[model samples]
Target: MEEVKFGQDINKQKHKKMNQTVLITGASTGIGLEMAKQLAAKKFNLILVARSAEKLQEIQKHLQDQEGVTVKIFAKDLSNSANAISLYNDVKRENSKVDMLINNAGVGLYGNFTETSLDAELDMIELNISSLVALTKLFAQDMLILKSGKIMNVASLLAFLPFPYYSVYSATKAFVLAFSETLAAELEGTGVTVTTLCPGPIDTPFNTDSMLTTNAYKANKPMPASVVAESGVDLLLDGKGKKLVGFNNWFISNLPRFTPDFIMMKIKKNLASQRK
Candidate 1:
């Protein structure tokens, strides 16, 4: 679907309740895509952003055809920090007012720090941290000006329980959790709220790959993306503050508080390494 021009009425569209639009990044797959589907079911217009134009278009058409809602797709590789700002500009120019922003795009590496490619880790950092910050800042400003909007930043269970093999990825998520907590407090009375979603291992495209077959990863059963997104959508729309998905995940995230750091790290390292 083409971008909505400035003069068009957002509420007068065919879908009666699709006036409020949600912008979701990494929407071609995984939690991001699942959240998009759920939001569409709730009659929210969608602005889906991802790297693959073909995939984005496919989802766009699927949603529009099935839900009778406006679906706009933007193909963007947000790993490059500048692209985040560019995306914000493009949305504004297209006259799309994002009522909610979901920073769901991220990357993870499953290998020893020394063994993993430096470039890959750098790209992961750029996508997981830099772009998230850029988009949150840009859109959060817009929301403040309007005095309305919700933002959901997807962190990981590893945000609080950083594992060894996923060093950089875990660190990036930790930043997301910390940043969202502070920002939520700052925007408390502004009417705009920020929510952090911390999911443990997810049955998303990222983990289905054979790359993460370590003993620790295999031991922990992953939650379905649909289930996690269901909680995420509700928390973002109806509730506020950080949400740790599932009881087990919440328990694991708090283990660090009870167990000493050095002992916990050793245990985490053992779990992250392959069986010898």
Candidate 2:
């Protein structure tokens, strides 16, 4: 596979045409919201999970009216970790099965590791790693029983190149990367596919306009949330392998292979840190 900045090769791109119900975590905002919109447009039934009940209600009504597809919204604070199983049970009670699962909820605290609040970072771990794993474990077992399903785990470019300020956040995503890739390999013959979406600095509230100061923002720029979501939804339904969004991002994910740890850290520091 050529790691070109020209974007994913059109020849290799896949977009399967199947109507499957998709449940997306963090579906009220940013990349998650964008994903919900794209999937709804494609006529897939949706199960949207987020922390905002009001926002979820609005989204449910809008998607239901506009797309004319069944939209189920669950207001869940998956940061609790234990709530992952509860949410799963809740969804199963309402709906018999989930054809696809998109684990997109995550949080990050930007600052020196020691300066950051331990409580906040711990909660982030629960949302970004623990809850994701819990849901994946639960849903994956069901998928294996049915002998068909897809799971999309959202990681980050920082997963490959750990940044200084986002130490805990990046580590969690690194865990996602390894966990997803290994799980994908494990589920190869089980008819349940696990695909990872590793997007770079996306122009979402999560990424923020403040990120313009970073070298990464200058070098790769911020891809629109819609673009990333489109790619993710397409990959999810099409049953493609892992995707790392952005042109420069694909190269960035592979840089660590050739660059020394010190040099890589310096570059990632510049990319993630404030630029003068």
Task: Count clashes in each candidate, considering only residues at least 3 apart in sequence or on different chains.
Answer: 0, 0
Worst ten in a row by lDDT for model 1: 6-15
Give each model's whole-structure lDDT. 0.89, 0.88
What lDDT tens digits, residue by residue, belong to model 1 across residues 203-272?
8778734445777667778889999999999988897899999998888888888998899998888888
Model 1's TM-score against the true structure:
0.92
Per lDDT, the best of the predicted structures is: 1
lDDT measured at residue 116 in model 1 versus the true structure, 0 to 100: 82
Candidate 2, TM-score vs. the true structure? 0.90
**Model 2: number of backbone collisions:** 0
Candidate 2 lDDT over 1-276, as tens digits, reads 466633555323322323468999999998899999998887788999999999999999999999888888888999998889999999889764699999999987787888889999999999999999999999999999999999999999988888888899999999999999999999999999999999988877776444567777788878889999998988897856689897789998899999999998888887777777
- Evaluated at residue 268, the lDDT of candidate 2 is 81
Model 2 lowest lDDT segment of ten: 10-19
lDDT value for candidate 1?
A: 0.89
